[model samples]
Structures are given as structure tokens and as C-alpha cells.
Target: MRLAALQEDEYALLESDCLFHLRLFEAAAMPVVEPVLQRCLVHSQRFKILNTEPDSRVLLETANRHVAIVDAVKSGDAAALETALSHHISTIVDFGPDVLPLNAKS
Candidate 1:
């Protein structure tokens, strides 16, 4: 399924990114990282939808941040990785609620 469609599937959306990270980590011979990252991603998705629809800027930012974080990890830059992760988490904490509209009940 396409990203837009997958983004709508609550169960699949975060899982998709987690799986991607898993593959990347595995290729880097760091498969052990997947479980922790996957767990965090899964838990975070429940409250913060990374692909919260219709916001191209949010999506772009998320993608860019992901790339930066991955690069930091790949390069074994502990300080850069920490900084990248801090910024990513701050963005999510600050903007996550703005992206998710209130659900209407019948």
C-alpha cells in the first residue's frame, strides 16, 4: 500500500517506519537496536501520529529528521546522535497535538 494509505492505518503506520529502521539497523550489523527503537516508535504512535495527514511540512520534517538521526547513528557520532534525537523528540512533543485534530463522536 502507498504511504498515504498506510498512514491511515493506525496499526500499520508506525510499524512501517519501525520495520524500515529494523532493516537499516540489521544491514549495519546493529539488529539489537531494533527492539528498543521499535518499541518506542510503537508506543509513541499511539499518542503522536508521525504521518498525521495533509501536512506536507510535518511529513517533510519527519523524514529529514529521520535521515539525520540515521546518519548520526551510522557514523558513530554519539554527540550528534544525541542532539538529533533531542531535536526530533522536542519537535514531536511541541507539535504533535497540533497535528492531531479532535475526533468527533456519533
Candidate 2:
């Protein structure tokens, strides 16, 4: 359809990707952050080219934190998971609201 519609669909898909990764962490043993982390890595490059070097570094650190979180989850280390999650949220906040998609309620 329209470009806006396409972007909406893309945003929804990415949100679903995060949700699926959370579900996997909740119900299974596998760490499903790979897909989301890979996307964030690409976003870092995009942010850098867009002259948002700070946000790009934040995104890269967030991706690295995801790897650590995944390892903590796989090892069943709840304390590590909590700390990692906190750092991850802080990194995203530093990345700022404009860098992320704001999907409207459907």
C-alpha cells in the first residue's frame, strides 16, 4: 500500500521480534536475542551515518549488553539478568525516544 503503511508494518514486525525474544526467555532455555541484537547492530551503523554518534555508541553498547544478558539467562543467573536488563534499559533511554519506533495502539 502506502509508504506510511509499509513503515507501520515494519515497526510492528520489529516489535513482535522483541516480544518473541522475551517469550523465549520466559518459557524456554534458548536465548533468542540474536535477531533483535543483529538489528540493533545495523541501527548503530545507521545512527552513525545520520550523525548521531552518541546514539550509535549507545546502540552498540546495548547490543553488547544483550549478549551478556543472554549468557546470564542461559546460565540461570537471575541477579545478572536483572543487572543486565537495567543497563539495557538505561542504554535505550540514552539512545533517546526519537531513535525508536513508537507504534500506535491497534
Candidate 3:
């Protein structure tokens, strides 16, 4: 992702980002969620691309976010892992409904 970001390759960065998360989703041992997640990630890909600005630091920011996840997973603590996952996801949710048109509140 970082390499793709540095190279300014949007497609590669998005692909790498999605693949990274897909592996984590697969790790959860839920077969049903894999396809669902793939669809969501792919569906959101275009919006993400559209929303990006040339100056945005997507990869660096994403990599920094992943550090907490990696550290938590490495610690082998379930509670810590859960917290890490929650916090990581919260970053996405923090954008609020405005950022995701489909999620907009009535």
C-alpha cells in the first residue's frame, strides 16, 4: 500500500488496501462474510477513488492505522485485539453519514 501510494497508483493502493483487510476478515473464520466483504470493498472502491485528492496521504495514514492492529494481534491478547479492531473500524465510521451517501441519515 505504501509503495503504491508513493508511486501514486490509485488502483494498486486500493487493491492492496482491500486485500489486506480481506485477509483479516478471512482470519475471522467466517465464510459467509468473505464474499460480503469483498463486495463491500469493491463497491466502495470507486467512491474512495472519487473522494481522494492528489495531496491526500491515504497509504501513509492507512499504514499508521494498521500498526496498532498489527501490534495488538502480535500481543496475542483477545481484549487488546478486539479494542484494536474496534478502534480501527471506528476511524472509518468517524467519517459519519455525510461521507458515505448510502449511509446518510434521513
Candidate 4:
């Protein structure tokens, strides 16, 4: 994942990103929710790659976030893990292209 990010290969980076999340769902052993996550991931893939190639800084930060998640998990730091997860989620939401702000007038 870090390698993909440093290389600036968005497709590979995206693959790693998806794999990381999917693995989380798999590890959780949530049979029903896993499929729902899959569908959501498909949209995630579209929103990511279908937009302009992401900035390299975003890719690097993403890689760092993944590492932080793993570190928290390995250390059994639930609070840290939640923080990392929240950061990752917020980063994705904020950086997403074609995603309109809720307060924007229609």
C-alpha cells in the first residue's frame, strides 16, 4: 500500500484501499453487512477513480492512515483505532469529488 502510494499509481493505490476495507469487513465476520459494504465500496470506487486522478499528497496521507489503523489494531488500542477510523472516513468524505455539501442550496 505504501509502495503504491509512493509510486503515484492511483489504480494500484485504489485497489489497496479497497482491499484494506474489504478485509476489515471480512475479519468482522458480518455476513449481511459485508454485502452492503461491498455495494457501498463499489460507489466508493466510482467516486474515487471516476473523478480526476487524486492528488499525490492525498494518496500519501491515505497510506499513512492505513498504517495508523494497523498500528492501533496491533496494539489493541481501541481509542486510537477509532480515532484513526474517524480520520480516514472524514478524509474520504471531505476529499470526495462530485460530492456536494449538505448545506448547498438545491
- lDDT per prediction? 0.61, 0.53, 0.74, 0.83
Cα RMSD of all models vs. native, in order, equals 9.7, 13.4, 4.8, 4.2
**What ranges in model 1 sit over 4 Å off?**
1-13, 20-40, 55-57, 95-106
Question: What's the TM-score of every candidate structure?
Answer: 0.48, 0.37, 0.73, 0.76
Model 4 deviation from the true structure expressed as Cα RMSD, one decimal place: 4.2
How many clashes (backbone N, Cα, C below 3 Å) per candidate?
Answer: 0, 0, 0, 0
Candidate 2 Cα errors over 4 Å, as ranges: 1-21, 24-62, 95-106
Where does candidate 1 have its weakest 10-residue lDDT segment?
1-10
TM-score for candidate 2: 0.37
Residue by residue across 10-87, what tens digits does model 4's lDDT show?
A: 889879889999998898799989999899988987876776557788778767878888998899999998898888
Q: How does candidate 3 fare on TM-score?
A: 0.73
Location of the lowest summed lDDT over 10 successive residues in candidate 2: 1-10
Candidate 4 has its poorest 10 consecutive residues by lDDT at 91-100
| Tens digits of lDDT, candidate 2, 1-106 | 1222234443443344456455645564544765675566457545534654334344444334457667877999989988877776576534445654568534
Clashes by residue pair, model 1: none
lDDT of 3: 0.74
Select the stronger candidate by lDDT from 1 and 2: 1
State the local distance difference test value for candidate 2: 0.53
Write model 3 residue lDDT over 47-101, tens digit each, in one string: 7667767543765675566777778888888898899889877666335445656
Among these predictions, the greatest lDDT belongs to 4
